[model samples]
Target: MVTPTLALLHTSPVHVPVFEGLRDQDHPGFALRHLVHEDLLARARAEGPEAVADDIQELLVRTVAEGAGVVLCTCSTIGAVAEARAAAVGVPLVRVDRPMAAEAVAAGRSVAVVATLESTLGPTRVLVEEEAARAGRPVDVTTVLVEGAWERFEAGDREGHTRLIVDAVDALEGVDSVVLAQASMADAADRATLPVPVVSSPRPGLRAAVLRCAEGVKS
Candidate 1:
């Protein structure tokens, strides 16, 4: 309560506990708040990510007005919009998958981007490429869309979702590193004992936001 200093905007309520657990384990004593906007992602999926730009911007600016020093957008479908408008939102807004994408591109030139949602895959792939461009590295990104995984997640079958994701990650033929596009798929990716490194968003993303909060850096 106390109007958390750090806030997370999420599309799925499931991410609340996932991030909370991370806060507890990694950033103890950090005040965190979670705001779920299921309809935003639903509309994005039905239409496209651009459809929810205004909604994301408005909601986040309001969150800053309420007292959150840092805002973390955890939905990949609309993450670009959130990050793009963070300065306008009046706070340091972190797009969760960006750090992971940057890390993936840094790990190697051959990057594998994996996602369960069609809405997520494209943006994540582009993000990795942009990171590569920023680093001036030539990257070959392979996008792996795990079939039927989102259905399992929507059905509240987390184990099934994780199982499918893990299996797909296992079968990846050639990639220097794997980037799990959705934070939801990260657990399964972590389960793999891959020769290549697997990067996921939540941990590095929150750490970056927390650092911004500590340094009093405003976006």
Candidate 2:
């Protein structure tokens, strides 16, 4: 029996450890490979989503060519574009926050999507709505951008970034669940002391990717 390799596409290097930890603990049998496009997010933010579509598509192609059983895009900002290019890659491509979105939609009627970057807000909200439609449920999705949090993250002030996200989670009212839109914000979900259930991408997303890899191998 051969173990399938799972490739993780990341826009930020910060997520490397998060997923690595999860894989080590839960799916140690599967091999993990990471391709980090550290500047991809900045390009998306400056030039808009369409500008990065080609780059994302090319990356997915490369990942598949490298023998990845499945590729998981870890950036919410580029998730939609990745999905658009999935057919071209001819591999199982997943968005890290996808599982979180489905969970959020199923967990409650009203869900709040909290993100540190404005670029993530739109894509994350769209994911939630799409999940709701797939589940045949009507969900009210709200987007919240934590001001100054991205700057803190860019400056390597993870503590500050997590603090802001925690505050945002605390402030979300009348929501049944809060979805942390970025993989980097997974730490915030752990730190948050909130009334509503707070969800993040790392664990659930990686688990799904591992399962996909297993399915591919079995097939």
Each model's Cα RMSD = 2.3, 1.1
Off by over 4 Å in 1: 1-4, 88-90, 217-219
Weakest lDDT window of 10 consecutive positions for candidate 1: 210-219
Clashes of each: 0, 0
Question: Whole-model lDDT, candidate 1?
Answer: 0.88
Q: All models: lDDT?
A: 0.88, 0.88
Q: Tens-digit lDDT track for model 1 on 81-140?
A: 788877765657889988888889888999998899988889998899999999999999
Candidate 2 residue pairs in backbone clash: none
Query: Residue 58: error of model 1 in Å?
Result: 0.9
Stretches of candidate 2 off by over 4 Å are none
TM for candidate 1 is 0.94
Model 2 C-alpha RMSD vs. true structure (Å) is 1.1
Winning candidate number (TM-score): 2
